[model samples]
Target: MSARRLTLLVAGAFCLGACSSLNPFSSSNTKIPALKPLTAVAKTAEVWRGRVGSAGRFVFQPAVFGDAVFAAAADGTVVKLQAGRNVWKSSVDMPISGGVGSNGRLVVVGSPKGDVLALDAESGKMKWRVSVNAEILAAPVVSDGMVVVRSADSRLFGLDPADGKRRWVYQRALPALSLRSSAGVVQEGNAVFAGFPGGKLVAVNAINGSLMWEGAVAVPRGATELERIADITSLPVLGSRAACAVAYQGRIACFDLANGSTLWARDMSSSRGLDQDGRHVFVTDEKGSVHALDLSTGSSAWKQDQLAGRGAGRPRVVREYVVVGDVEGYIHVLRKDDGSLVGRLRAESSPILADIQLSGGDVVVQTQDGSVYALGVQ
Candidate 1:
């Protein structure tokens, strides 16, 4: 098969049904209360993993297209893997982070330089490249032929996915909040939903970048709290009818997508990442703790510190487990009901910047070494 066609097939055909619909609130529930801590040396193993066998760290995690995985490393190399086989490899100058976008094409953010490039999904051939206003640290999101990117200068750009042409750019109205979190954009139908530096979540018409609605999320309640808090680092997670933004000052909040109204909010701290099972929303904090909150009422159903260490937690809920990857590269899969450690898988030896993918009866991870691994129950 031609490499381009293979890449396209992998992007569109693989077991991405689990990723396409991220509504955790609607998933089936089988609760298991938290279990006792494990003193036993966790029996963990990697089922099948692939890498370039090169010595370089991958700052960006791999993006999955069906069974295929794509990632770029600090050394400016891009590798594609299917199952456990290294299918193809390519390189660009100083490609620090960024991965394949929604369409399975590799998207690269040129580091120490301000450039963004798109490559053919299968062949690793350059398709297009564009220069932005500043360095890009976060990943880009593609929806409806539009590529929305966030740059270090606290600006958002909407580009035509066909040719990397700039469509519109929106600079933050307030001081450029050091945007460690990537800019998130989701298109439900006609509205483009996105979050900004000042904790404001806004929706713009997809065609013209016209403002539809805007609401501040995760903001300090008053002056008393303002002295203690900072920006929203967690990416905004979209659900069936709502979207959520968790903040650093310990707040878990959700907003209505249609009008940007506050649906629910709670103080949660140093929030890192979020996932939902369609009924319950799961959030992880910097302190290596996870909390399950009622999606509709904003009530806490359960909370536990499943991992405790420096850079130990950023909970990811997939299927039946609360999956967390620590700074040391050990991924712990805990029972979601109460918080029991179901399995532990060491996917990498260095810190992981990529999120976990639960798809097609497998747990997929792309490590900092630019390696992609899949663990499944046989």
Candidate 2:
């Protein structure tokens, strides 16, 4: 295999099914909840649709900046779209395992061959290519003039944006076993936040790649290694004062943005991520139930469990609603105040494995079958 496999996992990988659908607790409750009847309170429609190559065995989400959205697929296809039109398209000559990461100037993606490829965002030309020598499962983010790429071996490479030269490297200790995920590093201001295998969230200086502080989202404490698994499998969401993250078989916790102080934490398990609207933090638990928790106290404001076992992805807060996509390619728009389904639309027959991205007043999604749709709810 070109990609380095995780330790002690089945078939050389944990494979929560294809497209990261498997949870640690997937053994129980095998039934996918039947969606209750939804009386639409709002209208939802797909404004436009485009196409890219399939994501294959990995996740490929689009990167939105201004009017341009950059997307890629595992078949070496990288494309830039604007106004639902293809602006530029290029091939990387190699398959991409990770998704598109861009700053509107450079587009980046990770190959299964352990290489990071950067292309000019405007013209779709190759700018630079660098090697980390380990498999990169998550998207490489551009933060403060640095390209931050996380490899499967628990190493983060901070490279120069201009030439892909190594600036600094930060390494972490991986546990004996971990659930493989596409959780990438998120940049909030000058600090780059990342999650580790042991349910630890750390903030590092984006410039020098030095560790600033770390906090425990969930601790490893169980008799067996499977029971002790509590890795944060999603990107840490940032608010004005706090950074929040979720873990598989662990808890959802919010920490101080400046320091690693634990603000509040609640027992929750999810491989998908969360989003905050300054008032409430929105998340979908592992069972596909969406929730709204008080941002101040981590208390449950409301719970919408009608979609349990449907394999919902992260929560994206729009103006007055929370939107989430499920394995069946259904987009559910819920009332932010109350978790009632207000609108629904089916974008693809294939599953939506990528996190939702907001672009040009529409929720943009790249389905697992490589179809891109921009849907709007009103």
- The global C-alpha lDDT for each of the candidates, from Candidate 1 onward, is 0.63, 0.85
User: What is candidate 1's lDDT per residue for 81-192, written digit by digit as tens?
Assistant: 7777878888875555444455566454445366777777778888888888576656676664677776655567778878879888766564222224444455666676
Model 1 worst lDDT window (10 residues): 17-26
List pairs with backbone clashes in candidate 2: 16-22
Best-fitting candidate, scored by TM-score: 2
Which stretches of candidate 2 lie above 4 Å from their native place?
Answer: 1-31
> Cα lDDT for residue 371, model 1?
67
lDDT of 2 by residue, 256-321 (tens): 998889999989988888999889999889878999999989999999987787888999998888
Off by more than 4 A, model 1: 1-45, 52-58, 105-110, 176-179, 182-191, 220-229
TM-score of each: 0.80, 0.94
Provide backbone clash counts, one per model.
Answer: 14, 1
